[model samples]
Target: MVRNHSEDRTESIILPDGKIDLFLFLDDGVNFEIFIGGICNKPIVKHPFPKSVMFAISFYPMAAEYVFKRSFSDFLNKKIILPPGYMGFYREDMQNFEGFYRKACVTMQRIVTDPIDTRKVKLFDLINRSKGETKVEAIASEIGWSSREINRYFRKWLGITLKTYIDIIKFCNSLKQVKSGHFYPELSYADQSHFIRTVKKFSGTRPTVLGKNENDRFIQLTTLSDD
Candidate 1:
């Protein structure tokens, strides 16, 4: 959840964080628009109109597939507009963030009736537990699943390979350290150069510039908390 309170229009560079997001945009707190931000491997620049309030919910890979009941392959690197009342949400729910959050929770719970695959559940648990530092082969061994099968599932559901998804997770983990002015590699990168290169590959900027984050241009950096 996030909102832009600035009276003047502002630009924000959003870095990939390996999650699909559903965004609700209220221009001048009256007109409404909704967009789904698909998983991407690069940075995206956004310009929100003044007095616009934005709310978004990030979905896990498994929940995204089951709740939405569709493949996200076509949504990669794209922001697709959703039709009105796409998910049982209406103008009344958008009146307040609190109501919207409750409504969204109920909608998601009501829709997700299918049983989840245990292997995929374990796969995600291992990835989260390792913070994306574990190799695919190691994860496969730990979860008792084949590396080929894992990659096949990733490609089929998320439109990316296992290695790419792992890289994105690693990059996201580095964001907190970078936000606190720690530019050196700390998340199992080969070295400082490898860390910088990976950050640039995903964020389109070097570590120093991202650390400086002039004018709070990077949305994720500005929102991070040192907890």
Candidate 2:
């Protein structure tokens, strides 16, 4: 959940984190909008209205594909507005975050009428468990799926290559360290240069600049919690 308590609009930098998000934007307890944000390869600058609240649910690729049965390929780096009452969600759900979350869970369970592939589950689990540091071929071999098929499924459902997705995962996992002023590579990155390049590629800035944040402009860094 994100809320802007100030009287003026705020700018936020949203970095890629390999998750699709559904957002409910409520303005001053009156008007509202629903939108879905897809996986982005780079940072996005968002301007939210002042004195508004945003309720959001983040979904992994598997959930988006199996549970929601929706393809986000067309929404890369973009957000699409969802109609009112879409998927049984209504303005009334915005009364509070906890109630909204409970209702969303129930709705998701009801939407899953078909069995999800176990292999796909293992594939995603491995990537997350490894913090996207493992080799793609190794993940495919362990999951009993071919690399080609895995990549195809990723592109079809998530709108990106498997390799790119893994990189995003690695970058996301490194954020905590980066936020603490550790600019050096802590994951599977080869060296400082490689790490810097990846950080710049996704964030459009070097590690030092990102860590400084400079007025708490980076939403991910500002809101990150230790896990």
Candidate 3:
């Protein structure tokens, strides 16, 4: 959860790691709104209300299929407002973040009752095990599939090609290092220049600027916590 303390300001959402998010926004006037957000490959800006509280659940790339019963590509780079009565089944106090999280977990457990997709599970496991360093060809070879076939599966289920997903995972891993004050040269990128350029591309700001922003810190916290 996040609470903004200043005047309404535009926040840049950097989701270099692919995800689908569910958000609940509670403004100062005590009105609540909920939205389902899809995969984002680039930075997006939104103005949030002052003193607003937001609770969000970031879903794994593969979980979208089980949770929503739709192809992940269908909601790519999109946000859809849920119906007004969507939260009626839960009776938790909205002000309690932990309570809200418990309610969300219960709801998700009920919705995700379908059998697991073993292929997708193995793919996700392989990518994570390699720490985003494995090449697409290597992954495909290990999985006994052609590169083209692997890419097709990724696009059909995750709304992005395999290469893009790998890039996002690498970028997010490097971002965590940057946030931890371990911005050493030759650590993740080729050099300092390459690091700065990649960070700017994914976050819409250079490393220095991103590190100094309070809102960005919160964003990083949320991203890291999801992992």
Candidate 4:
């Protein structure tokens, strides 16, 4: 179930999963995510947080955007005081949670970590799409700007350069097909090796840990963080 209200907060329920939920802040690029790890359910008092969030259960690689966008990190770092409900991602907005508890929590997590506004998705989408095509500079030119300007803009908002984003996208594109049985009947060993190498050069980890979907995979909150 998906719902968007006048408040610009958008949320929905995807197929149930034990460990994850992706929530998007609609009309805004800001994403709030909630990750359910382990079984710790003890209520946490609202507190500040500061630190890049770990991408998932596995820690083979780390992302600055993943951890830094978290407002919880700010709270933890004493950057600000959060109301009781806004401590960690899990602790925020529990009272108003009408349903989909897990998903709701995930949304809250994204709330803390939203890096760019909603409109920025287009830029990312384009960059991701470019993975299957030509050089980054050429892609930039086709998109309207010189490679330098594009890279500069991307870095200003994404914290990583456009080159890194492209790497992440291309890597994920290759890994996704492989992981989804795309290779079951067709991909050659050479094909697999190339994909792994490409992904490793950018992510320092392969599909197992840093696969594209491994982050906030749902359309609502999916993003390709820098390598």
Winner by TM-score = 2
| Candidate 2 TM-score over all chains jointly | 0.96
User: What residue pairs clash in candidate 3, if any at all?
Assistant: none
The lDDT of each candidate is: 0.86, 0.90, 0.72, 0.37
* Model 1: per-residue Cα lDDT over 20-93, one tens digit each: 98888887878888888888889998876777777888998887989888878877888889876889766566
Per-residue lDDT of 1-227 in model 3, one digit per residue for the tens?
77777775665464556778878887774777878788777776665578777778888877877887777676677788886557442223457888887877888888888899777788878887766767888888787778898788878876788988876777777766666666654344678888788777777777776656565533653456424
What is the Cα-based TM-score of model 4? 0.39
lDDT of 2 by residue, 152-201 (tens): 99889978999999999999999999999999999989999999999999
Q: lDDT score, residue 89, model 1? A: 66
Better of 3 and 4 by lDDT: 3
Worst ten-residue run, lDDT, model 2? 3-12
Name the runs in model 3 displaced over 4 angstroms.
Answer: 6-12, 87-93, 185-188, 214-218, 221-227
Instruction: List candidate 4 stretches off by more than 4 Å.
Output: 1-122, 130-134, 181-193, 202-227
Off by over 4 Å in 2: none
Give the 10-residue window scoring lowest on summed lDDT in candidate 1: 1-10
lDDT of 4 by residue, 1-227 (tens): 23332342233112111111222111222334443222111112222222212122211012223433431211211222223223243433332344335654474466455464433444555654554334676666565667787666554533445565555445445544544535321322246667666544543445454434442333212332233
- Measured with C-alpha atoms, the lDDT of residue 85 in candidate 4 is 28
RMSD of candidate 4 to the truth, in angstroms, is 13.8
